[model samples]
Target: MTTRAAGVATPRRAWLGLAVLILPVLLVSMDMSVLYLAMPTITDRLDPSGTQQLWILDIYGFLLAGLLVPMGNLGDRIGRRRIMLAGATVFGLASVLAAFAPNAGVLIAARALMGLGGATLLPSSLALISTLFPNPRARATAIGLWTAFFAGGTALGPIIGGTLLHSFWWGAVFLINIPVLLILLLAGPFVLPEHRESGRGPMDLPSVLMSIGGMLPLVYAIKEIAAHGPAPIPAVAGLAGLGVLVAFVRRQRTLAEPLLDLDLFRRPMFRLAIVSSTVGMMSLAAMSYLVGIWLQSVRGHDALSAALLGLPGAIAVFAVSMIGSRVGRRLGTGRAFVVALTVAAVGNLLLLGVGVDGGVGFYIAASILIGIGDGLAFPLVSELAVASVPPERAGSAVGISETSFELGNGLGLALLGSLAALVFRSGGDFAPTLGETLDDAGSDTGLARAASEAFVSGMHVATIAAAVLLAATAIVAWRTARTQPAAAVGVSAEPVGARH
Candidate 1:
């Protein structure tokens, strides 16, 4: 029989483990935003080419996507805590290296290392939560906390970065990870339980390689297309990547332990959730990145000012998301998803009115809408994704959903961000007075500011694209919601306990 604790004792270890699991999410989301602010600072110091700049930005997500499955599988085989701690350690070290790096190339390399570490961190942490919290109510509550961290991180990045920038430099943004990781390292071993995969199958090496080969090239090609329109290199790379992906799927069909279980998509709810999440990310992620640049570069808002504009969204997300699970239960999950998507599309359209001349109020209002939309949509989508699989395969399914999120965010920024850059460069639009003033600080600052206009324009392009994609997704999800059988899917109205 299981031992029972007396006198209202809660499991401190499990709660601490859950906190450790969220550390990576906090770091990754914060860093992603901080870099958008830091880009102007980085380019001023480093003088990287436009392409190199995109690489520095896109590589982090690309590498994260490329390695997530294999690393996630490895963690399952070895131990989730062991893998997560190892990842945290690597990430911390990479951050220190990035902070002190002298050249752009070194910094880019360090960021890539950080990405690999991040891939390990996300899947392992998610799987650990799944393993720790087996009860549905506990799992929902735990996942709710996890979702809260994501929103918090997204909102907090600029505040932290702005503070750091005032006292230090761009590198400080990276350095901040060290202290967080150090704390995790000390606490993790003592508090987090070790859990290992119970299944028996060889890790599929060939499938892993094909997945990496296919995804990275495709991501790279897409980034290139965004940067340079339909360039030959991107064209060839895109075609090659697609072909490799097709072959990878074919190989997965025969493999005993496939890196990604393709059959998961056969479930209508799972398929719809992934598709909707991708489109959501494609829209929201692009807008988030672009909005930062537009605020700082075009509207001349400081880091803190730009972050403040987003405050309404963050607050709305926190407040609205509290009601999301209930709403999902009330409306039916698919119907709830449709409603959320529609609201989000409207939010994106609202952002179209926010121009360089618009007052701060407009931007803030737009952010609130976007935040509410996302707040409503993301959790529902996550709920649908998690509920799609049997409890036994939950770990793997969570990894897939996380992978989609990371890839969607990366692709949104790369493709939409790049298109904005190209449009601005082609138009030759820069604020001469602002350019002169920035130059007065130094030549580095001048070049950086000059690049800022293109960046802002790029952001606009991304916002527009995001809006279009979200609108399309809303239509698709609404049409598709009719087919889902209510009996096959269960909605647990009761509160979930810790996904420890």
Candidate 2:
């Protein structure tokens, strides 16, 4: 009964398939933040050392970021559906293992396995959307929904985790992913279509190795620097990662079948979209991290209470993400970027008025503004990235776009988070994070007050820096939009790969 129009699948089937695909996307994003509220309980139960605890919290993201590109390519050569189903199996089994892990080491290993599965799920699901909805307008809508689910999952993670932790054991966080992923595993084969290049060459093993090597070290370096500030080990690892990436790029140029299609960067719109995605994510992630700390540590709200207060912002993000593409079409993509980023910058500036004593209203209002801006911008970036490439190369293009998101998230924490930490340290000899500072303050009211003031001061500086960065990026987006024609910025139906 299904029909095709200009080779695009029936809308009903495509939309149904999209529903199946988003299951993994939601789970993957949730896993990233779900641990936030559960960490204390996990520590109490597992008796992990500081280093082990860090690994349990971090290893999943590290592996997930590192493997995204290679896995995306793998999906292109094989089949997106095939890889996705396989990944779901891995992810589901790993989640179970993590839930029942007897020790910290086992949990770390299980989390890493989940990351490996996640890498496959993200890009494959996105690329599948490109295949499913070839019409430009439909594709934009699909990506917008994808963006909403992603943002919603991240926002819901702490709230969901806190809710589960109140009644169930700490392991309930990991257990929650099972039923959702199981639905994906069962329904995906029936609903999703298989898509792959007909004559793609075998994957370049060396390129894959180089990518993993470069990305793992680079992400590790960023995380280490963020957590403990600059050290010799992280510096060396970062330099080494850079060198490997340079070599990888050079190797790609020589290969008859490169792992990544480097030529995608030649398109101005593609390049601009990647940069926008990176910077936008960076600013959003930085603000989210700081706000979570500010609510819990400075405002003395419990995890559940703070999450409840932030729910309205989360709702704003989810609501706006659905309508962002329509807004872009009405205002023009360039003007849309300008308006969105400016709104976000204003939100960041509003944080400047927030204080240790009474800024709950300010914080809530600022979070909603920031959420709206991010919701309006992120979907456009994803759509542009996929639309800029040929159908056959959507997977590669999506890989780069998703990689930018991962890197941006890490860099935001490293760079801006580090800046905030420096300002806090300058105020006094204190622990690296506000939580630790308050914990150590004990009954010392004066010490707690000083720590709170210092934390707010640091948050103000970081938000100002974030606002400035967002404003600058918005300016660049404006210029890019003006120079490029409607088609160049992803408005036209023509594939950018054809132009090159």
For each of the candidates, the C-alpha root-mean-square deviation to the true structure, in angstroms, is 4.8, 2.8
The 10-residue segment of model 2 with minimum total lDDT is: 484-493
Scanning candidate 1 in windows of ten residues, the lowest lDDT window is 491-500
TM-score, per-candidate, Cα-based: 0.88, 0.91
lDDT of 1 by residue, 185-303 (tens): 89888877787767648788888888889988888888777666688888899899999999999997887667787776766566667777677766666677677667776687877
User: What is each predicted model's overall lDDT from 0 to 1?
Assistant: 0.70, 0.80
Candidate 2 displacement at residue 201 in angstroms: 0.9
Per residue, candidate 2 scores C-alpha lDDT tens digits across 242-316 of 899999999999987787778778766667667776777677666776777777778867667866877877788
Where does candidate 1 stray beyond 4 Å? 1-12, 390-392, 429-459, 485-500
Error of 2 at 18 (Å): 1.3
Q: With candidate 2 superimposed using the best TM-score fit, by how many Å does residue 77's alpha carbon deviate from the native?
A: 1.1
